[model samples]
Target: MWLTNARVFDATGAAARDGRAILIEDGLIAAEDQAGAVPDGVDVIDLAGRTVLPGLIDAHAHVFATPPTPDDGAEPLWPGLTAHFVATGLREALRMGFTTLRDVGSYGDEVITARQAMRYGAFPGPRLLTCGRIVSATAPGGRFFDGMYREADGPDEVRKAVREQVRRGADFVKVMSTGARSVELEDPHPAQLTGPEIAALVDEAHRLGYRVAAHAEGLAGTELAIRLGADTIEHGMYLNQRPDLLDEMAAAGQVLVPTLSCYYGVASGQWTAPLVRLARHNLAEASRTLLAARAAGVPIALGHDWQPFSDAAVELIRLVEHGMTTHEALLAATATGARALGLDDRLGTIQSGKVADLTVVDGDPLTDPVLLRDRAQIWLVLQRGAPVAGAVFDNSAAIAANARTAADSRSVTHTSALSNAGRPRSGTTETPG
Candidate 1:
């Protein structure tokens, strides 16, 4: 497939070009194959006024469905969550232009199932890396968080659980290292795992060929996760409040996923409305910490930690609002996100010979990050060089529609959920890629 008349923008940090084209062969970018650079015997697609870019990757997401009414103050438990529900939302994600996602948490192995389906062409979505269930000790997490967690007491139990998840076809493991904001469905506490336990999860994951993601949001937990070798920190909003630790994470080449929007959403009177004041203060501090880390040479990637709709692009804009140069925010979402997911080798850029996961935008995002926030200006998306407008394209509109429903008016009071209330669910916590 040849995509012509495209303007390519990617993390190479170069200027956006007009009339650029991409040649995709066998689901990989065979070459940049610029405008009028087509080879013999290939189909051509005249983009007509569109810009193309590497497919956008939302590196952190929960490919699980959410319950309609809060989880009745209980962590939403699941043993029956289906892959279809997740697949339902994935169609929307693709339409919204997100070609890939990382499932950071799920109540069960449904995320893994969803990933396999997409990989084998049984479903539609960007590429995925799924961390089975999350292992949370008694110190902090509560029951409402559901099957995603494995409550363990010692290193042995933690190690066993980590191995079990890998055996279940997990691409990675997730662990809860610290306490989180108080919410009804999720009872929050503090650093639930000790240093040894945290270390055990990471060590075992590495040995077993899986990366471990830590849900760390406190000083002790953050430091411990870093020390224990967590591959990524789910919501490092607290890192800004503790620069020393953030600096340490940077120095170690560790990645930080500041689901920066989730915290701010909490402040906006969504779920956990009463804590708005506290969330606000935390938001300011969180932004600063992330900025400091970026300045200090830390690899900061953008993760929505959001349901499909909350304007995922808004998550990137928030980074700019928090002091990241527009270029930095784009990198965080593009090159940085791919690196965080350990997919830098193929995805993240628009260079020749790279996978054709391009995201083309109208003005240079480096000049104005908000340009990315404007979905109307997104132009076109190429997943391995296939247009969103053609066959073999993942239907991402479904994800955007789902997100719109989430951001739209809800008949239920916000009291039933957490901050910035999340995605629509049919009793499961499934988010499309």
Candidate 2:
């Protein structure tokens, strides 16, 4: 299959190239060639000069239902219902142009089950990589987060916890190196685990050939995780307070997933005053940390640790607003994210021999990254050379009819096909609402 006449952004932190075409065979990118160099008898899908990008990746997300609030007076959903919500959330993520999601935490084993379901083709969804449950020390967070935390203490216990997650089919391991801001009983500043415990956890995970994603918020814990060789730091918002750690991360090739959207969510919501205050403070510090990390050459990846799977693109816009360039932000969501998840060799950029997962947008995202947040602007999404979701698939009947009529007139055009696909074009260059 040939995807022709498109502006291709290979997600190499570079500008888009015009009049390019991609060749796909057996679910892999075969080659890249000039748009006008297609051989005869090849199936072609013209993009009408639209922007094509590597499929986006979210490195830190939760697929389970959010824990209930005390004021809501509702019990947690049943296990089966939780699984259903996980499935729906994953499917929604795929429709929004995300081809891969790395879930750092989820309730029980629902993430593993959802991964199995998607792998078996029970439903169409993005590729899933999960950490079965968050490994936390004995703390108030275990009670606050319910089934999401796998509480353990001591070096031996933490090592066992890592093995347990491996046994549960986890693609990676997540360890809480510090307390959480959301739980009022817990403080976000101090380290939650002892040095030996965290060391054992990271060592065990690495020994097993699995990457460890450390949930870090405070400077003390952030330094520990960085020094202990955590593969990725989940939320190193206070890293600005410790530039030395950022330097170490840059040297060690550790990726930082700032998760800026989660702090924004908490600060803007009707949460308790203290939690909101902490969130606002962390949000500001995170902005400074982002700039410092960039200066230190620390790799940053996009991770929307918020709800509503469809709004994942908001992280890209947020990254740009914080300090990164639009091209840098796009790379954060694509190449850098894949690197964070240890899948860069197979899934990040658009190059020969990589997996054929691509997203087609109606306008240039470098001009206005906000267009990625609009569902209507997602022209087409392909996963492994197969059309999975997007405006094109949603309006296939109309597109087919228009193609037939255009063929009769001998004036078929990709623009007419897009018009029939019901894509909204007027707001493609608009700013965020």
Candidate 3:
């Protein structure tokens, strides 16, 4: 498949050629050049004045569990992961042009299921790397009952916990280096993991051949993870507040995945009162941290730690609004994120041998950064040379149809329910008032 006549913008910036074409063969970008360079027999797709880019990547998420966690109490495990919900979320992600995502945690086995399905093509989704769960301290504010949390007091337990997650099929290991207001479910200000404990987990994870993404939010946690050589710092929201920690991270060249969307849920009043209060302090800290990280020369990647894929993509735009240049934010979602997941060899930027995960939008994202968030302008989302999920967004009706389909499905679900069991059946369907 070849896409031609569109603007192409990526890590290299935006460029327009009269009739340039991107030929995709065997899921890798085979050739990109002037039109008809690949021969007439090849499938040619024309993008009328749209902008094309590498398919986006989300670095952090709870892909298997959309709602994040349920209101379960004292359970070692949260509700299990279902193939259905994971697949649906992946579908939504792929439809939105995300060709790859990294799940920071999963409830039960859902994320693993989704990852396997996508890898095997049973379900269409972005390429996935998954962390089974975020291991935390026993009394840590972020502990989630019995679900994925494996409580550890010291280095010994932390090391064992990492192994357990790997045994459970985790693609990578996530160690909650600090307690944050968000996951506490109660406590907003939490304690940081000891350096030794964090180092233990990191050492074990590396030995097992998995990259480590530390849930390092507070100053101490961020510093500990960076000093110990953890792969990436997830949600270094308070690293800016602690100049020493920021400098250390910068000096060490640690990558930062600032998940602004996590605070978005709290500040947006989407969470309960306690979580909201926790988010209140976090929001400002996170904003400041992002700019600081950028200034300190810390690598910043786009990781929508939010539940669904759309929210993650929005974080890409938010990164720009905060401090990142359009080019920087795009690189975060593509090259930076791919690097964080240790998949840079395959995914991320556009290159001759890289997978042809590409997206075609209507305008240059760098010039008008808002174009990155314009779902309607996304004319095409291709994975491995195939048009997957919803049709290209360039077709106005396709966009409207997709939107209407969502609304109609929702309307039917909420307003089209049958009469109550004991009540008389109504001849007409009751609509949402």
Candidate 4:
């Protein structure tokens, strides 16, 4: 297929170029140039005046979760309905221009099943990488959330739990380093896993070639996780309190997946007064810490921690509100996120030989980034060179059929060894290329 007449934003720290043409063959990008000529008999897709970018990635996601109700406490509200909830979230994310989703934690292998189904063409959705279940201690986590955790007691048990996830085909390991504040179920500031236990789990996961993601909110927990070498830190709310620690994180190249939308939801009055008062302090801390981290050179990636998949774009806006240019925020959702998930070489940027996945929005995000939060502005999405969702074309069903055929015929590897890079920046706009 030939895509033409669009402004192409490569998301590779390069300035945007106008009127470029891209060619896709066999689900991979074949070529791109300012005025490329197309071979005869190839299909043509005219993008009008829309802007093309690498498809967005959500580094921390939960495909099986729905919007939380304050009334629904610590357990699964609806039993045996996991598949339906997960499918709904995945479809909605794809329609909103996210082509890659990293599901950090879910109750079971539901995300694994979803990944295979999406790969084989059973449905239309983003590429999926999941950590089967979160490993936690039996004392605090197992007693409350039995369905979502594999509760174990010590270093030996934690190592075993990490192995259990790998045996279940988990792409990575997720451990709860500390309690959560939003749920009010456990101590929010104390470390749940001891240094030795965390070290044991990390050793096992890294030995098996999988990255580890830690749910760390407070200073004590975040410090322990960073010291133990976690690949990514989730909900780093207290990072501002220790700028020195932020510098350490920068030196170690640890990626931060701050889900600030969680706090914003509370401040926006999504919940009643009691919850609002409970969430305000933590929200303020998250806002301040995010700006500090950006200033300190920690790599940032966009991750919408829960439901209302459209809210994923809000993370980008929050980064800008804190202190980031629109181009930097765009790179967070695209290239930076891909790096965090270990899929950067294949999916992040719009260059030759990468998979042909692109998102075309109606307006220039560099000028008005909030437009990304509006689903109406997301005009088209192409996954692996197939038009899966859009205002112009809907070839998802056809793409699914092809995906199934491909999966059956070959063994495809979606997971990669974890790695990190130094801080990256974007280029200022100049004369159109």
Candidate 5:
């Protein structure tokens, strides 16, 4: 397959190269050549100058996050129904041009099951990497988050928790070094786990050939994670308060997943006034930390940490809004994310001999990062050189023919439903896509 006449970003933090062509064979990028270099009889996809990019990646995601209702304190659906919701979220992420998602924390082994399901062709979805559950110090968060946390006390217990996740098929391990902001009974400041405990967990995970993602919100916890060599720091909002930590992270190659969208949701949601206030404060600190991290040369990755997975691209817009240039933000969502997930070699950039996962947008995202959040602007999403989801798959001709046939038969009801079904919905609204 050849994609011709395209403006390609390549996700190398460079300006788009216009009128280029990408050649794919056997699910790998064969070459990036001139538009006229295509051989005869090969499948040619004329992009008509559309912008092409490496498939987006979300480094920090929670695939099984189902916020509870305030009244009943229960999730909206049962476990069985929630699995279906999880599957739908994965498909939606793919439709939005995210070819890979790194789930930092999730309930039980559901993410593992979902990953296997996609691998087995039971469903169409993006590549998924998950930490089976968050390893947290024995705290109120365990009860608050239910099945999402694996609470342990001493260093030995935390090491056991890390081993448990590896046994359950986790790609990496997530450790809660600080209390969560969403849990009302817990504090978000101060290190929740002992230094020995964090060291043990990190050691165990690394010994097993896995990376560690540390949930770091406060200065103390963020510093500990940085010193302990956590591979990625999730929500290191308070890092701005400690320039030394930022320098350490930059030196250690620790990626920071700011997760600005998570705080935005908490501040905007109907939570307690104090929690909302804290979320607002954290949001401000996060903005400052993002700029500091960039200046310190620390790598930043895109992590939405919000619901309705399809709208994850909003993180790119938010990153740009919070002092990052559009080009830097694009790199955060692509190359940096792949680095965070340890898949940079094969998945991040549009290079020859790499897996051909790419997204084609109708507009240049470099000019307006918000174009990434617009579903209609997403023209084609290719996973391993196969068209998985996109507006290009709408088959408008067939839809119109069916509508005309219905109109000729005088079946107005059928024609109306068919026409309406083909129209795209706005925003993060769920669809069969």
Candidate 6:
């Protein structure tokens, strides 16, 4: 497939190229040429001034669970129902152009099952990397809801807990290293696990060949994770207190996945009152700290961290508004995220030999990142060279017919011949919406 005459943000540099053609063959970007030459009989898709970006990657999320809605009046559901909701959430994420995501602290092993199903072509979903459950302390505000976290006391139990997740085939280990806003804590700076306990957990996870992601919000917890060699730091909220720490993180090459969208939402009154109060104080600090970290060369990865999937775009906008350039934010949502998951060689950038997981926007994302948050602006979504959403197979008629239905509903009937829904391939042109 040859995608031609479009502005392409390859995610490897600050600028997008115009009038370039991306040659995709066997789910990989074969070449991106300015001459727009095509082999005989090759399918050429003219993008008509639209922009192509490497499919966005969300570094942290509970991909299997949906955020609570006001109209959701049903009683608590069983595990099966919860899994169903999770699948729905993952679909919404894919339609939003997140072709790759990390399920950090998925409530149970359901993500593992979901990952297997996606691999087997059960349904169209994003490429998922999952950490089965979070490891936390037994103290107050340490352990989260049952199924979401495992409570372990000392080093021995922390080590055991991490091993259990690895045994369950978890891609990584998520450890809660400090208190968060949702927990009932007097101050957020206290570390949940002692230094030795966290060290043991990190060691066990690394030995098992899995990266360790620390859920750190406070200064002490962030320092502990950094000192102990955690692979990624999730929400380093109190990073401003010690500017030197950002240098250490940058020097050590630890990726930071700060879910600024949560605080942004809270400050905007999307969350309830008590949480809003907490977020009001932390939001400014977090914003300043993020800028300092970026200036110090700390690699940032975009994560919604249980925020709605669309908030991933919002997070990128916030990063740009706070301090990062638009290209830096794009790199955070792509290259840095893939690097955090250890999949940079296969995904992330739109370079040759990388998977052709790409998102085509109806407008330039560099001018307005909000286009990513708007469903109508997403023209096409391709996962591994096959369309999973948007106007596939040149079917603007189908997309127009389903215009009233939201991309998040997971009810739009994808044309079998052009999608990854276990269908036959055919010659078709997918145009901008």
Q: Give lDDT: candidate 6, residue 258.
A: 77
Candidate 6 structure, TM-score to reference? 0.88
- Tens digit of per-residue lDDT, candidate 3, span 264-335: 776788778776886877878889999998988887888887546654578887888788887888888888
Q: Give per-model TM-scores.
A: 0.81, 0.90, 0.81, 0.85, 0.88, 0.88
- Model 2, position 51, has a per-residue lDDT of 89
Estimate every model's Cα lDDT from 0 to 1. Answer: 0.68, 0.83, 0.69, 0.77, 0.82, 0.78
Q: In candidate 2, list every pair of residues with a backbone clash.
A: none
For residue 14, model 1's alpha carbon misses the true position, in angstroms, by 2.8
> Candidate 3: which stretches are off by over 4 Å?
13-19, 34-40, 64-82, 140-145, 183-191, 393-433
Cα lDDT of candidate 1 equals 0.68
Q: What are the candidates' C-alpha RMSDs?
A: 10.8, 6.1, 10.8, 10.1, 7.4, 6.8
- Runs in model 4 deviating more than 4 A are 65-81, 270-274, 394-433
Scored by lDDT, model 4 comes in at 0.77
Order of the predicted models by TM-score, top scorer first: 2, 5, 6, 4, 3, 1
Q: How many angstroms is residue 430 displaced in model 4 relative to the true structure, after the best TM-score fit?
A: 37
Which model is ahead, 5 or 6, in terms of lDDT? Answer: 5
Off by over 4 Å in 5: 65-79, 396-433
Clashing pairs in 3: 75-146, 76-146, 76-147, 77-146, 77-147, 78-147, 141-184, 181-188
State the lDDT of candidate 5 residue by residue for 32-110, as single tens digits. Answer: 8667744544455667647999999999888963533668576456557667778888888988999889988777667
TM-score of model 5 (CA atoms): 0.88
lDDT of 1 at 173: 85
The 10 consecutive residues of candidate 6 with the worst lDDT sum are: 424-433
Tens-place lDDT per residue, model 4, 1-433, is 7777778888889988888888888878888887455455455555556789899989988776564456756564576566766777887888788988889877666787777666656667777788888988754566566567887778999999999998887888998888766554677677888889889989999998988999998778789999999989998988899998889889988889888877777867878787787668777888888889899999888888874786678888888887788888898899889888877888889999998888888878888887787777887777877666654333323222222111223332221111122110111001100
Error of 6 at 409 (Å): 38
